[model samples]
Target: MRDTNFLIENNAKAIWHPMAHPADMRARPPKVMMRGSGVHVSDIEGRTLLDAVAGLWNVNLGYSCDPIKRAISEQMDALPYYSGFRGTSTGPSIQLAYELAEWFEPEGMVRSFFTSGGSDSVETALRLARQYWKIKGQSDRTKFLALKRGYHGTHFGAASVNGNANFRRNYEPLLPGVFHIPAPWTYRNPFNETDPAKLAELCAAALADEIEFQGGDTIAAFIMEPVLGAGGVIVPHESFMKLVREICDKHGILMISDEVVTGFGRTGAWSGARLWGVKPDMMTIAKAITSGYFPLGATLIGEKMAEVFEADKSGLASIGHGYTYSGHPVGCAAGIAALAETRRLRLNENAAARGSELRQALLALQSRHPIVGDVRGQGLMAALELVEDQTTKKPLDKAKMADVAAATYEADVMIRVSGNNIILSPPLIVSAADVEKIAVALDVGLLSAV
Candidate 1:
């Protein structure tokens, strides 16, 4: 509603960004997007660009998904809000819950504990894991395990299990007894091992070693993303998750798959767990659950936890955590419609087809661009890690990365530059031409940076 100059002048004055410095943002304001259509967005400057970030990796069906918009509108008119707390429930929430349970059944998820967003979903899952242990009479199993470079969320429990120090340093004194194992990243690892299968084994062994050292019985769960999203899209080997699953099973530890980004056909599969044929004990689903039409998330409970809680005579099985916006009617309606559209379109197959092309193009770019240190991704998610020196692999300067991203935007593609990594996660509806446009934009970015 406000003019561009009016909005830009007061952008950082009233609001602080999620992951940026206030002073720095005031110095250089972020882009203000005014409109979106299909997989493209238009900024206040009247420049339209391909949204390679996919609205923070949530807009899978893109801005033009009419079914979701209609559902939200209809739900707003019918029932704007309703609490899914103790006694009352909404129609949309109940239907969405059943849909989700059926959808994630392959991963063994049987029930849904709704939340407001990804962070809430993760926080709920963590709390649910701890409660499950307590209900099982293992109160001492309060610790958690996560893979290094794996990001959970911003909540205290999620941050404690987050492997990125940048997100953890300022929020110290986090939940205690949280340990991290080395991820199966081939490019950068303590092992310096390049072979995928071998690196997977090494990572699995590290998990086993951690369990032995920490006393597995004391650990409540091992939480990780099937394909790491925020931490440079570090996709582990095909066998890596299965290895972790086996380790968790052996230790009686719950496997909570953080699928906020990889869910809803983003990972070329129904879910990341299904991608590797490993069924986790729990899953945090959000982001694309409503296809960015509304904020909605859920901590999907597996059959194991469901059975324990449902059949429990103990009061410890009772859930003690909830959010005000949990199971919001409009959000649930959006999710139900989004899931329908996602399945009807068979977006998973499209992601597989398009992601293969995108991967090859990025690899080619890496071959041409000396600054490109590495390329890693699965399905629609991918990243280009930049370096100052090809031989030494020194990370590209942040200033240079900013310049590259700016250049890419100028060239009509909007990409996410996190740390030295240029992350690209276009909408699942992205076409072959869109992938080429992204590739071309990145080429321009690399040239500008160099």
Candidate 2:
């Protein structure tokens, strides 16, 4: 029995993958990923896959980077784990926090808090918002509002604040007092209006109306993604986000920007909040923090909010929340190294250049394929929306779209499919030649699907 077969059999017999049924997986064993280098990953069968989605939109530095690997190794040898409690912190942890804060201050960000991952980071933001109001004597201010079709994380608090109904279907009893508003998907145009400024005003007014209807005094925060990620890679007009900021300010609701997918060169900028100029009270980041070299996430709480946490009304009872691995030494080390490498290589500038070329290439695909209804986004983060009829703007049947994605998986490239929207978040290190290869394979896959 070969090692590959042995590994597959053991995986089938023992492991349970996320979002998969065990019975079905037994028949069709999972792909055995063995190694990765640059922008490509290889399976045990010696097949290489172009990771267009950046290994769940985190592998910004791609795989097998010597610097990040070396940092992690050195940290593990020195000290691998630590708790964020007891008023004690490690060097890597403190340095990483300082670096993150510096990156945000120039963009008007004030302070930040750390967390284990995106879900917890978002939860941290929500909790801070509630606490801020509580300390200010607004006990009734507890409700939250989010945008529809957004993907924030999978935790209970995150799901309660998230707008996607599919994610909340199974769990009936969720954290109450969270509301959802229309997303900024201009393609679908739920408001049934164009004219950028008018659209922005309408959307902003709707949010204000919702806040007023709920009683602005009762709402603590409004959470959203500047440019939605899993919610079909939808990009909003510049004025729309600005309008949202104004609305949040009017209602005194803290705006928490969930940039888990759009941070770190995904949108040709360090943070989507910076590019759009919609500064949030708190920012939840993950995915590219360590370039997928390790599992780490952080929640950046701005100065205004940090002040509330710093007052320490309760000597020992101040912000009684923490994770065993909140700032794991190894993860912090990787983060420090990753940020340095990003600056050294100017990856954000690279994203700006490649993203323009990639978007053009994707739009060109629409010219060749009628199914391609829309090609939109910035930097390496982009999406191609499929439609049954371009005139009607009807989405391809959900089941049909899944079939299309499964078929596309057989090709050389690995792309992420969200309903009729095919997402593309290729590694920042991808070159022009790599982009062309991906385009050719994706073109064939789209044609075959149609």
Candidate 3:
């Protein structure tokens, strides 16, 4: 067995984790994961911990999945890599696209374009929105809008369109012409109303006003997460999404749903867009697409937008798009297997069932812990907003919350905290019992911190 000190030292010397301060991390020397199985992971010391965030909101099939492994192995042996250019395609790439198009039908129009990951896929959507409007003879429509606190990804275009302060603030002067409006967070409603309908109107009207102020002709599209994942797992009011859809339609703005975190059974449906019955003009998907078994993301376009490209078939006007590893064979194979596994096991139904149990348990904790300001979510994705006072709904100290989150990791339950809110997005394969253990671990950590 490898020496524990050696492993920790090596990781500290070489590896850099996302969203972590390297200096402070050296003192703790990050937990080195040796292996994972089902909903648990083992460190170098053979200590097991329940995986609550599902490996950064992917790994929907849990760890050590045999089917996905076999599928990937078979494809790698046959043809591991290929380009989707010049009329060439691989088996898994073709099959998975067709399957997903069929699955997400009736709610959103569809056609798939592959990328290496979520950020790239989101960039593709933003660029496509501009190009589609151009093809429709509306070249002035170049501006893009997203909700505040929304996290699309880290790429230039995606980051610009994303509304996360920390993600964009450091990297200033992001892509020009991107705008942001208030998110539909009912808990701390900007409208100062508790009613869902009023809150929905308040949020959608904010977007409408922004579009009008900027001149509708200059705005290309509006992108948003159906259930704000990284942004505190904020679920929109009941009628909010529909109103957003109506506003987009009225202004001829293409709707791009960034379902990177909420897609593929995360919200007890094939896509959260389907759960809410919102017909987006386009979709950017990743995460559970391959259950984190491989790096893959896709941009799904509506039929109306596809026709614009279809009409430009004359090879004269260029579409200037594509990644070197666009339709990777192994990633596609993993995606196919992941989708098949999710369907066969009825993972969406499981998420809804387990999520219901999680809600009740979390709400019960609210009665006991004032630090848990609010509990909100749908299906398997959820959040516990930590607060200083329950009555005033004052958020806990940001640094203190981060400390609590870091401590929870030591407790052997990997839960993520976004801006004072403990975000829990376990794998779709997570069982009811696993949910209970995760919640209990979180409670212990929070109480200890308080």
Candidate 4:
């Protein structure tokens, strides 16, 4: 094995990180994680830190999930590689599809179109949505509507619907006819509305207005995260998603719940749609499907979508898009094991209890620290928005966030610092003690930033 110093030296030099500047890497070298156990990871320097980001919001079962590892190894030995593109199929993939159908049955998702990861799942969902409209002979229904702070994925199709400018600006000339509506974020919204129910109604009215302006027949789908993830863990009002569903139904537009981050129990329910008591037309899911043991995702279809795709004799109904690894047997095998463990352990229940505790702790931290301007979350996914002034709600600069993040690491907990928000999504397997540790670490970090 190479020495720690050697690996650390080549970390930033060897690879270009997806969402980071090349120059910034030189200013602050990245940490090289050598190992993970339970909820803690060890850096190359042998410093073990509690992981609150859950390996980019995957790793639901934690690092030492023996069942998933065993499942992957067992499947690899049986069938190392096979394609699920049309004529070919794998056993694990078939079983997984059936399992997913059962798992998301409550959400009305009856079918699963597998993908390689979250981005692929999102891309697949968008394409399927447009295709759904085409099959219905409403070819003009090609536009998409999304929330302003939503993060769909990186593909041109996905990026087109993504509301965040940071994800869209550099990749201009993206798919046209995609529009955005204001997110029902009480902390910061154009309406300045603080009440959740009223905010939800206003956001829903905005969606209806956009559909009216664009002509409802011209809009294919309204895509949104049940709980906005990458843009910051902004948990919408309980009524927001339900209201969106009602509007989409009235407009005859499909609802695509981008559950890439909120899927598989991160949001205290089996899925975020269930959390809000809404059943979407399609759901783009990944992340916890295989619990980070493998790269796997799927665009889950509702019964209505199934009927359209199945009943169609038209060539337009044929799915032209598919990844080479649409349903890799090993990935599906890991998913089966992960899902089983997820259910057996009832991670959703744990997430609910832990999430409530964590949120209260964050509220306490907010009371003590003036820097914490806003605290938002649902279930295990949470974020603290740092600000220069609580009254003005002026966001704290990146330098200060970085300092706080560094301090959190010094306190032996790793957190994700995005823009001015400090995001925390610890593994679902975390216990009460673990939650306390995370809260204490954040308290220390907040102190440094203050």
lDDT of each: 0.93, 0.83, 0.86, 0.92
Per-prediction TM-score: 0.99, 0.95, 0.96, 0.99
Q: Write the per-residue lDDT of candidate 4 for residues 359-388, one digit (tens) a residue.
A: 999999999999999999899999999999
RMSD per candidate (Å) reads 0.8, 2.0, 1.7, 0.9
Q: Determine which window of 10 residues in candidate 4 has minimal summed lDDT.
A: 2-11
Q: Of models 2 and 4, which has the larger lDDT?
A: 4
Our model 4 lands, by Cα RMSD against the true structure, at: 0.9
- TM-score, candidate 4, is 0.99
Where in model 1 is the C-alpha error above 4 Å? none
Q: By descending lDDT, how would the candidates be arranged? A: 1, 4, 3, 2
- Candidate 2: how large is its RMSD? 2.0
lDDT of 4 at 183: 95
Over 4 Å off, model 2: 21-24, 194-196, 312-317, 398-403
Residue 288 miss distance in model 1 (angstroms): 0.4
Model 3 TM-score?
0.96
